[model samples]
Target: MSDTPPILVVDDQEKLLRLVVMLMNRIGFPEVEGVTSGPEALERLRERRYALVISDLEMEPMDGIALLREIRADDDLMNTPFILTEASFDFEDINVAHQAGADAFILKPFDMAVLKTKLKQVLNSKPRKREAPVAAESSLSNDFPMLGKF
Candidate 1:
């Protein structure tokens, strides 16, 4: 295999997923993989190591914050860089993502330039190791009613 680590992109929308994967490839990420759901993303992560994970903020069953919490709780995958993307300017969502240990958050409709810059910054930076495991049942959803109880 090549020396470049692979990247995982998760999005419920197939078209968006394909577009993001294509963008990553065009940006020089040769090993970009896309998954349709949070569970599928987790399965992919367990199957192999990835340089980073770019996931959408809104998804059924498990949202980006929920997925992030799960990753943080797992010792093997906890330190992997994670970026959350959303289609809106919801400040509340951003705050929860930060609290959930996301490495970066990008609003949707971002240009290629913005995506490239954010990806480079996240991919190069070391993710902060959590001092304690994330709660199995995070009350973050309760705090953010709009996000629903994940």
Candidate 2:
């Protein structure tokens, strides 16, 4: 962990991504990176470690749920905190995000204060332990069967 607080913001919407980056910067998280897709997010994760990953739930190619699943599957990245955001907080979506190993959930169109508070909470929380390989494999293979097909 470097002294700088690095964060990854993953969202397909360019406007949202820029807004998040700006907000995070204003909140003292200067070292932030943004990506427009799950694959790009994963690539960024591979290249460097981030204190937290804030992702939008709905996206083209790989959605946030599938991205969360993939992140949890990788031992090196599994323990990293993931904050999922969606425009709506339907029970099914929340449950699926939790099941996929999301550390926190944020609703879209959120106030900057709410996002800042949640980010602080997650960053202050204890580091997570990597899930067992068997569990990770199951999570990746079972939860979103429709993932790769898209």
Candidate 3:
């Protein structure tokens, strides 16, 4: 990835997805990309490197947590910064995401200022270069939300 790689924003809501993409581009990520589903987001990730991923917590087929888990399980993609958002999350849900290694969390409607700050933080997080061999693979599953209260 280059110094400032592109960004990916995932949300099933088209309007909010566009809004996030527009605002991110306005705030410095001119290559911001948006996808409406978790599967599409995964496909995009396989296609190119992304500086950050900002995803909504709720989605069909695969939610943000499932997307995050899949990303984490991939050795090539594990270090990418992830920022998950929601309207409001139950306390337990927050903890579950935290344990799963979310880089940042934001509650919507997004405050432009806070969003910018988080974007900067995650985009700037340099991945550690590892000389060691490939790490053990962890299985990917979409059962995260069940561990948390709705």
Per model, state how many residue pairs clash.
Answer: 0, 0, 0
With a 3 Å backbone cut-off (N, CA, C), the pairs that clash in candidate 3 are: none
lDDT per residue as tens, model 2, 24-87:
8888887899999999999999999888999999999999999999998898998888999888
Query: Which portions of model 2 show Cα errors greater than 4 Å?
Result: 130-150
Which pairs clash inside model 2?
A: none
Location of the lowest summed lDDT over 10 successive residues in candidate 3: 134-143
lDDT of 3 by residue, 20-135 (tens): 89988787777888999999999999999888889999999899999998988787888889999999988666667766667777889989888887767766776734455322
Question: Which candidate has the top score in TM-score?
Answer: 1
| Cα lDDT, all candidates | 0.83, 0.82, 0.80
Off by over 4 Å in 3: 1-3, 126-150
- Error in Å for residue 58 of model 3: 0.6
TM-score, prediction 3: 0.80
Quote the lDDT for 24 in model 3: 83
34 Cα displacement, candidate 2 (Å): 0.5
